[model samples]
Target: MVIGRADLHTHTTASDGMQQPRENVRMAKEAGLAAVAITDHDTVEGIAEAMEAGEEFGITVVPGVEISTSAGGRDVHILGYYTNWQSDDWRGRLGSLTEVRDNRNLMIIEKLRSLGIPISLDEVLDEARKQGKDRGTIGRPHMASLLVAKGIVDTMQEAFDRYLAAGAAAYVNPPRLNPFEAVEWIRQAGGTSVIAHPGLYGDDDLVEEIIRSGAEGIEVFHSDHGTDDEVRYERLARQYGLIVTGGSDYHGERQGVVFHGTIGSRTVDAGVLKQLNPASR
Candidate 1:
């Protein structure tokens, strides 16, 4: 494919991202990226459409998923690449994770109500469905959008800062899979697992723990990562013999604000995609 730059992490309407899966591909193509990954939260529903878009745009789409987990009293995300996405078992397990996301959304909505922000789950779903993504994963970003719509928060960042981010008012951590389990799940499903955005976890020790526990790669360059974070994680990747990956973590724009970054803002060489593929590895 003569691949060049590849953004290895991004969300779509299949999760909380404002754009559709095809639209993300189009953006990647417009950004002059050779490849992009659709690592939607707890779901692979966007992969098919993204692949089709890739064909249309002459860009490569790496079928991927971002599995959300809790570890060390913090939210962690595991990115799976080149998974057997069509497997019934893989889809079934992801279905269970979606249930967890569903419960967490409800809990956040209830907490928002307690804080005098009268938002309903149905309202959030309706807003999400505005893009005809009714079956996609519902996340805090979805709820945060509703908060902005209701004038409860001035912006999505404010909504997250005041209510959705960890330790915020509406924040709720339900018992869920840990990073190790997530790694194993990806392995069992014939995919390589990568520790995503380790800088966001704020626990290098635990991030290393996951690396030693079987993560095959580390996201060294992420939209939210600083230069120091990139250097540190790049060093760790070399030390542990793990594949080094990077991505924009793009979630599209909300209220004229880009969530993490634009597509192609942070990317690794497209050659890294081969390392992320289990078969090639």
Candidate 2:
């Protein structure tokens, strides 16, 4: 009988997600959600449409973005909530990061080619185009799809295992923000920064470092988190006096939409939103 009212992490066609912004809103409404955060990766392109659809569908849309950063040699995702997406200053920042992402994709493809994988940028673009993902957001997952299409890999996991994963032959570090930089940018845009899925990252020590890095909140409810993980993060949030947010991290069926009816099988209420961003209330 538990109901979900908010999903603080999600994606749309503006990034690697399968659905368009408006369609994601519709899905949220259909699931009886009152609010959903469109935390598209590195780009705020989908926010406008999602907000528009939210109005039409009677759902509250939190304008957010998931900025990819690196710390301790691991990819860390920082979620920004209630951010001002219309400012040129903010857009310029994301634009630069997107440019870096594009360059990194090319480098990865070059490494793959060098490794005799026969994967090309064009092939990856074709897969991303089919999925309707944005240009700046083309990533290894898109490349993996091309590998599958070419029968070079059996699955996306295999593609990553053989080539794209960190420390793999094709791996290359891209331009990235440090933890502090990521938090600063979100705050600069008048948003609250939250560490996305602490459990997915390294040990509790690293999570503590992120908390100290100026993140105002932490994601406690995620499809990737189990009960112990949730409890651990919740305790950490309380201990550190940081806001607690939750979401399904919904990408789509292709990304394995296991928590379909709820946001990671944990209902998020409006109080968490208010805590994370007073403006959200």
Candidate with top lDDT is 1
lDDT of 1 at 145: 81
- Write candidate 2's Cα lDDT for 1-281 as tens digits: 22347888887778877788998889888878878888888999999999899889988888899998888787888999878789988999999888888888999988888878787787788888887775448767778778888998887777788888888778888758887799998988999999998898867787898789788999998888889999999999899898888888877654343322233344478557676675644
lDDT of 1 by residue, 1-281 (tens): 34699999999988888888999999999999999999999999999999999999999999999999999789999999998999999999999999999998888888888888888988998878874565688988888888888898899899999999999988999999999999999999999999999999889999989998999999999999999999999999999999999999999887888989999999999998778886775
- What candidate 1 gets wrong by more than 4 Å, as runs, is none
Per-candidate local distance difference test: 0.92, 0.81
Cα deviation at 217, candidate 2, in Å, is 0.4
RMSD, model 1, all Cα superposed? 1.0
